[model samples]
Target chain A: MHIGALHISGVNLQEVEQKVLDVAVNIICDEKGKDYLIVDDNPGSEILVLNADSAEGSKILNNASENQVKIVFSSSTQSGKNIITMPTPVRVIALKNVLIKIAEQLYAYIISKKGHLKAVKKPTVLPEAQKIENIFQQLLQIKLANKCSLISSTGLPSIYIDGVNGRFITEKSTDDIEKYLNLDFNSVESKEISYEQLNEYSKNMPVAALNSILWRCALACSNGKLLPGHSENTPVKLTSWPNFSRHGFKPDYFKLAAIMAKQYISLMELNRQTQIPFKEITDFYNAAFAVDIIETVTDKSKLKKTGPIKSSQNKSILKKLAQRLGIN
Target chain B: MLQLNTDKIIFTGPVGAGKTTAISSISDTPPVSTDVNTSGEERKLKDSTTVAMDYSYIEMDDGTKVHLYGTPGQTRFDFMWKILTKGGLGLVLLINNDHPEPVKQMEFYLDSFSDFIDETGVVIGVTRTSINDQANIEDYQAKLFERNQIFPVFEVDSRSEGDIKVLIQALLAILAN
Candidate 1:
């Protein structure tokens, strides 16, 4: 019998890896050896001992000519070793199986952790933000298409906009547009206007005012996406003109949606030098505001769906948002 | 609740005259629709109703809501016509001249909504069959004048939301007066 021992650390003996190795090595030894009959000496290989006192196990160990069973020890808490008893001359199948199983366990852990880390690091913007961005792009397209061409007799002067910087364009071109058209766009003055301009502007201001409101909303909802929870105190990306009680403005979802609608209306009312009808703008805004409650509720619900969307939902969301603004 | 305000003006028109696309061109909520007509014809390879008459509302900054009721153009859904016109301030009757009896169809809608017209008045949105027909809208305007008091009438593309809004606003001015 072979008396050999193997020290396998880094594994709790009760764990699957150590147990598998013990079973495989024991099975290989018993199949080829006779009890107390053989004696061999092999010192190069590690040994696993399940039965320490059997004479057949000692003889097999003494006859281990290939140095296959180097050492053997009991598998008790204090033993701290793998079981190696008999030595088989044919093959070392158990050692190979144990190593393969450990590799598989390690590979599985790495794969699962990699997936978990990815889920934890996804983008956190709200889906609604993409929708708003798209709406902005669509508005830009509309505005660009309807952009005034200054037929200065020399040629149409090209206005280069760095981006959708309305304030930049307006500041740059307000004087020129006012001077060329021979109308005092005096709102550019102290942001000032006379009684007549104010009235006409107010009557038609619904659209432009509304557009500004949506612009604010798109701003407030910066990178907003429909997430799966509601956080009321979370800062809305747009500025809220909620305090304008003289006009009966209450900053709610309807007000927000109303603002967006007003924005779209204002965009359309600016047909080069053509004045859009005030009543038409009013009706369009009125119609959109009429559905304010429905939209707000829907917006609230949608914000709870997931993290924000990618950029693809922008165009469709913009078109939908434009209608909500009652642009026509 | 999310009820459409009762006072908003609605533009009720017939199909194949560009209702949904027109409304959507300007509508904010994709124009809340119940469109069996579009789906039905789409499956059969026939004409589709761009706008199925449904309800949508717009609100003024002063909190006044304008509800637009788009009516399907098909005569089969004419039952919806009456319901749609119940509280309407006016109607934008889209008269498709491509129809064999376009004038007659306009008359049918006008006559069908005669009581509503008597109360709220109506406008004519004439879809010109060909661009060359200079007096086509005027011809319908004349016909409308004979049937009802001269209401606002114009050549319009039902697909354009802005154009439709202009038509409705004209009707609104008439109603206000």
Candidate 2:
């Protein structure tokens, strides 16, 4: 039976093409005896007839294999068994059978290889739009967590501040701080203090007591009320032990803040100790201040000017972090 | 007969993070799933959740077949998490950004599979990030950093074949390294 258009590529291109066409129509024609379009230059032609002995045929075969395009070759050709081949004499029936067989084999191969062809492409670096979106997301989370808000200064419900016991004992009537601390509010004096007075009162207290009072004060602060003298260089100390699991601060930051609270540390010192970004430290500072867990040390003489820390050190730390992340 | 030559990678995430959909996207064959209708709180997110696991495979031209297994997201089915990771070469942790606590969920999964992760490698795919970008890949990376971990994290769409491939490819690359 006549196969469809076959591209003849060999030393004797014209002769092969004509002979194949005649054989296809006269002896191997299909039920309708239709003429096959045996072209010499149709690269898109599904069927290819290549002479085994010719260099051009070898090149075509190599090209086809590289492109994953199957071709019909003369039987004498030294090629893989997976390739389709027919005798060089161009017997009419043999040619017909070989063409039909190649078509069937190609169909089966295509069917079997469909899944392999569907492998998806690899992803590239995130685009700027995606990066901007990511930043927006982080900001939203910070806002939702109230990490971005300033600690309120006044009208906080009366909390019992006990320096000797190292606790900011709150009234049993208050639901906010008690839910977190789970402490008995009984037998404690309830007093309301302004942000300035609380800061003044915390100056003489032990670090532990200061930690408790400040954390309570921070918790008591109204949302968006700025803590007094809250600045990057402000000397601050953690007053109480940080409950990491409860607070949800990153472990490293929590550890750094814990270290800072034990000893009076300026915001800059905390940043240097933790290598955490200033903005993050500020967020933590605000949160800590609002809850009265952190207090500013007014003794400027104790705050030695550690000098200007190099951004290179911070860069190296970031580089190390990026390296750990396997990002070049 | 024991199929010792077969290799596999595990997929895990919170409920509705698209673990099943991810496997189905890249699997050469229709994946086998043991999903059932989600009851109680989980139903609010999706109708069905994977009860046991999801399974599918991709056969390379060199005759190597890599199996994909997805674990159930809910903690109630966490028992299957360890079971499915028996022969896994690595893990692809898919976190849904739109979830109430995406970072918390990431930490939970990483902790749950820390043993397997310590043995093999892991790559994270944060899905639905476009829907809610508040908890980005860096946030997850920061959490991993706290654990002293460094993993490839990407934003992916579970329904996209390309995104799933990128996630799997990143895991394979980590394994190769």
Each candidate's lDDT (Cα)? 0.39, 0.53
Estimate, for each residue in A1-328, the C-alpha lDDT of model 2 and write its tens digit. Answer: 1133333333333475446544543332221123333434454445555565577767766665333333344545344534444435454333443444344344444445653342221111122233211211222222222121111213333333332112333333423343423222232222344323443454443333224334343433323333333457766665432433223343344345435633567778767866877666665666564333344554456456332222232233323322332332
lDDT: worst 10-residue window of model 1 chain A: A237-246
Over A1-328, each residue of candidate 1 has an lDDT whose tens digit, in order, gives 1222222221112244344344444432332122211222223333333232345544544454442322332221111122222222211232332322222332334446554231111112223333313323323222222121111212222122211111112323322322323222221111222223333333311112223333333332223332123232232221111112112221132223223311221323222213434333333233222111111221234334322122332233323333445542
Candidate 1: segments with Cα more than 4 A from true spot: A1-328, B1-5, B37-47, B50-52, B128-135
The alpha-carbon lDDT assigned to residue A290 of candidate 2 equals 39
The ten-residue window of minimal lDDT in model 2 chain B covers B168-177
RMSD of 1: 32.5
Please write out the lDDT profile of model 1 over residues B38-123, one tens digit for every residue. 56654443344533366666655554455667777667777766666665555667766666667677778778887877666567
The i-RMS of every model, in angstroms, reads: 29.4, 26.5
Root-mean-square deviation (CA) per prediction: 32.5, 34.1
- What does DockQ give for each predicted structure? 0.01, 0.01
Q: DockQ for candidate 1, please give it.
A: 0.01
